[model samples]
Target: MNEKNFEYLRDQVKYTGFGEGLESELKEKMQQQEPSFSLSHNAHYGTDTATVTLNFKKSDQSDMYFFNSYKVDLQKDNSKESLEQTFYINKGSNITMKEAYNLMEGRAVNKDLTSKEGQVYNSWVQMDFKEADSNGNFKLNQYHQNYGYDLEAALSKHPIKELDTAKFKDDLMDSLKKGNVQSVTFMKDGQEVKHYIEANPQFKTIKAYDGNLKRIDNRQTKDEKQSEGQNTSMKQENKRQNQSAEEDGPAAPQEAKKRKKKQFNSM
Candidate 1:
């Protein structure tokens, strides 16, 4: 990539808030004891920012982020924006966020974090759209701020690994767009009751609850569960009716007698 392009992306990155608060205290205490390493990188592009926080676990492991946590703000302004990408670090889920930063430049974010210790953790990403309205058109997959950085064109000549975020933001965005078997929400009156209603994608969710506060299932899409409702009970009911004739009489006997009479006449 050209120097201008590189500088544009570099400006979005800041090592600020590094070794702050608990990290500072822990590192200070560790220095008195043994030694440790920790990592924190908060990348900002446009109005959105991805905050990285790696808590300390072992000594001399300070350079690496342990028990990682990542938070990606959909909008920079906090009080108004509610949609965010968040994930907690767990066993075998720890990975790097280098790819995630690239994604902010219109690249892809990896799904796991890698450490010098070779430990892994699941990057369980959740896209919180609780504050989004039915008319909201915020797309998570697309890069919100390119900042004159033509990352797509640059990758044609350079290796993508150079910009790998090694994060899970892309996976979460893909899953949301594909409408995976993820949790949706419902509401009661305006209280927002998060119970029941797989709320199939058959319809667009306007409000979680109606004016009366009842959970509204506008039911715009039909899924497998809806198909399951179409049982063979109708056919079974026909057979039962034949054995115990209803007011309309035995349907099978009438057809059977007609068949026998037709055979005798032919003979």
Candidate 2:
């Protein structure tokens, strides 16, 4: 969506409030009978009108729930001209403006957001913080306040997938043995959040945690592999060319030198 004159409230809703809500409502509307979900929307008019929408859903089928919120704007009294900003929320946890953009930029979750069951909880804001460069709009903190639960423990308690179970065990065991993990992530209710691995001495990539395997980008993996194969073939062809040139013996070099001398003498 697009807007004409209002930007403040849109910024608050898009970068700060929650994820997109208009589509979320449609999703709930479509999936209403499958499960009962709620989409509550509020519009705040400060110099202009801003619509904020939030959605919630539950699926015990997978022992999980999902929540998302978003915002839209139709300013200058031109109802046809609408500007929309959307965000996703897991359970009640939300992504800060920076985290959202960072995720878009392909950043990985490096913080853990879990505590041992029955353990005292700590605030997420207590950790180190960073920010992103403004596209001349607003300055967004690179990290946000953690709002979810301990990811490792929760996953161990309720695995997302069968494969996730094996990965989860290794993550926990690595934590116990190595003593520190820079970050770990988990979902609560329906939202995704992060936690810092307290025993972090070396940073582990998500793929490594998932078994030190290479993560394949489904969209480009095949193309990438083909490109590598082509590069190897090109290298082999170049090697053959160089070997053939050497095999042509010193006669070619002497002839080339003679040609060079003739050219210089003619000059």
Global local distance difference test of model 2 = 0.39
- Candidate 1 residues 97-163, lDDT tens each? 4333333333233244444587543232222233433545223332222223232332222111212
- Cα shift from native, residue 64, model 2 (Å): 6.5
Q: Give the TM-scores of the predictions, in the order they appear.
A: 0.24, 0.23
What local lDDT does model 2 show for residue 205? Answer: 14
lDDT of 2 by residue, 1-267 (tens): 112111322333354534455444444353444453544555443344555444544555642334444433324343556444455443223455433333323333333333346333323221222432332112222222344334354333321232246776676644433223334443333334343323211222122232233342322323433454555565675566556558878665665556557755874
Which 10-residue span in candidate 1 carries the lowest summed lDDT?
198-207
Q: What is residue 59's positional error in candidate 2, in angstroms?
A: 1.5
